[model samples]
Target: MFTRKQFVSASVGALVAGTLGACSSNGSNGGSAATKASDDSYTLVQSGKILGASDLQYPPLSQMNESTGQPEGFEIDLLAALAEKMGLESGWIDPIKFDAIIPLIQQGGKADVGLSAFTITDERLKQVDFTDSYLDSNQGLVVKKELTDDAEAYLNQAGRKVAAQSGTTGESWAKENLPNAELVPLDDAIQAMTGVSTGLYDGCVADLPVVSNLTLNSYTDLTVAKQIPTGEQYGIAVSKDNPGLTKALNKALTEIQGDGTLDELKTKWFGSNI
Candidate 1:
């Protein structure tokens, strides 16, 4: 039997193959970002318990840090802001794989919503509904600084070994754009960068901020080579059946952006008003 890790790496790629589209634009709130879908004509469930889940990897958005040894990143802060707006007390479950979040909601109704930095894609849309975009995340490739000039050449190469966080949009982008390349999925950006450092993978594909975080501090040797037109957007996800949950969250998300609360949080964490 394939282990969960191997199965996730192998089958999930096949499961999501060839079904990505341009990500939606960020919301006015600047606190959250998502696809610009026609608003769901559903009602927010008055039931009070809202569950939040995120993969405990990928820094500046969601990752473990040396200074805190706990999960602290942009997404967590953003979600906290979202929760404050809704007056909803959220119950957080950690270490869930990105792919499993939708299923957990669909099957168990385990979470009222998901709070990970999940990208919006049509393939995922079939499984769960998404709120308006809260962030704009362009796709990018990170490699050793020396290979900056050879990025386009590398993308054109066959079997280029690229690393990504398991079940992330980065992994999905690699499957769509570089199908011929060997996509090596790690658990987090730290490991992804480590793979590049150890010569285990030629490069990594991830959101611009993740690549930025990697290069800005620890991974000095790594640099972003090419920016792919992923037009990626991140949003909160809920079961399509939960129209009520979706509506309330979307409203809350919108208010955050409209009132500049989102911008405040963005500046606090990111240093530039997003």
Candidate 2:
């Protein structure tokens, strides 16, 4: 899981909209034979492409490259590889609101799959099916330098304002674990981190990897105060209407894991940190 500070500007959004419009047009006319699957065991929103939906606001996991107006990250690479393994084109990745992805997939005819860093939980299983676990992660707390080092004590302090990304596990964890603390839900992790950096919030909660990345690379003034090991596992979500697709994804994931491809990817992205 990860989050970046930049959002799609109006011009960038227009560019993306134009690109997707072209994709839709070409998809109707068989853009590429590679995207067309000879076998009909599974369904796809687009015939010749695996349509993937992601927020594209998360870094390392997924983020938009402003220069190309396209997404690039570990999850994007993995999804491309998965598409290749399934005998489809590189795949059409559409940037969407993170929380809207699940609902769109469940409603059908939008995307073939959701490739964000979605943690597998019992509550989510009721809405959509998930493939085998890919990444294991946990929640983390980030705060300014002056806060007490004792995370528990800091959280217990009255009137402490904490921030978390809306609709994320971090938000839920903060609400449950720091009931007395004021909870501020923001659109993305960057906003939460910004809140902490500007003293708008006492601290912020987010995925451990995200907090670490932001602190190390972008928000140097901030630090990871504590790590909350929630034992979260990320997975690819498939529509409940497409069990066959889920099975196919699991098979591909197993093959990749067994062949060391997954390890190579982890090493490439996480380096010595893994």
Candidate 3:
């Protein structure tokens, strides 16, 4: 029987293989010519709806409300504001796997945008465009209380297992920085932290806000050992083919920022700690 750790590792490996194949075939459709129109003339993927795709498992950023079965998070609220400002109806916000959302955007027609806690990077920019960043972030480590202060030291040693979400900057950071440690790739931040709490992993690497939020709210046994200052920034992802949508989102973002709506949302969700 495979342990949970083995199963997760195998699953991520398969996902990476599938993602590579999908990317090769999709290769930026640029969508229909209709999607390439000017910002003022562009139409929604679906009439009267601003379709969004996200993995809503990360709390404070994006999570599902179990009682209402509706998506609710800082990113969700921000997207709602953007959709309203763009004069589109509150359309379908589909829940999707984090790594798959970019591919869906690249393929087009399925979603108009992606608003998970997507950190904008040059590599990601090659596949899809991003609106102006709304949040600055850093990579953080979460470990069991026993390893709290010495988590970094332990992670630096060989045979230590450190987990991170596959395809995220946190994973890349772990690979680059902890070359001697065994890198465990999980599906999301929540799972990575859970693994740490259960002693499946020595530590979990994820966004600073996410690790902090989870540690404070849900996983009291976990502590943020170190915050790696990567100076990351989260942005709303749009298809490379849909420059018009990108422009419109940027406009809405600027308005929210200028009118203090952005700050208010940040305070409401992240508090002064962020």
Name the candidate that leads on TM-score. Answer: 3
RMSD, each candidate, Å? 14.3, 10.8, 13.5
On a 0 to 1 TM-score scale, where does candidate 3 land against the true structure? Answer: 0.85
Tell me each candidate's TM-score.
Answer: 0.76, 0.82, 0.85
Q: Report the lDDT tens digits of candidate 1 across residue range 1-274.
A: 2221332344346446744342222122112123322233222222333557777676778776668766677877777777666654545665787678878766533455676778888887888888899888787788888889877567546767888888777887788877777888876677888888778889988788777777887789888888777788898888776554577677888888899988887776666774
Question: Which runs of model 3 end up more than 4 angstroms from their true locations?
Answer: 1-39
- Cα error of candidate 2 at position 129, Å: 0.4
Best by lDDT: 3
**What is candidate 1's TM-score against the reference?**
0.76
Q: Per-residue lDDT tens digits of candidate 3, residues 1-274? A: 2222333345457567774221111112233333211233343466555778888888899888999999888888888888777665554456878899998888787888888888998988899999999999998988887777677888988889999998899999999988889999988888998898888998989999888889999999999989899999999888877676687788888988988888988898998626
> Cα deviation of 28 in candidate 2 (Å)?
5.1
TM-score quality measure for candidate 2 = 0.82
- In the predicted model 2, the residue pairs found to clash are 35-48
Which pairs in model 1 have colliding backbones? 29-257, 32-134, 33-133, 33-134, 33-135, 34-132, 34-133, 34-134, 43-244, 44-244
Please write out the lDDT profile of model 2 over residues 89-187, one tens digit for every residue: 656556877788888878767787888889998988899999999889998899886674786568656899999888889999999988889999887
Model 1 regions more than 4 Å off: 1-49, 65-69, 155-159
**Candidate 2: residue 155 Cα off by (Å):** 3.4
Error of 2 at 199 (Å): 1.7
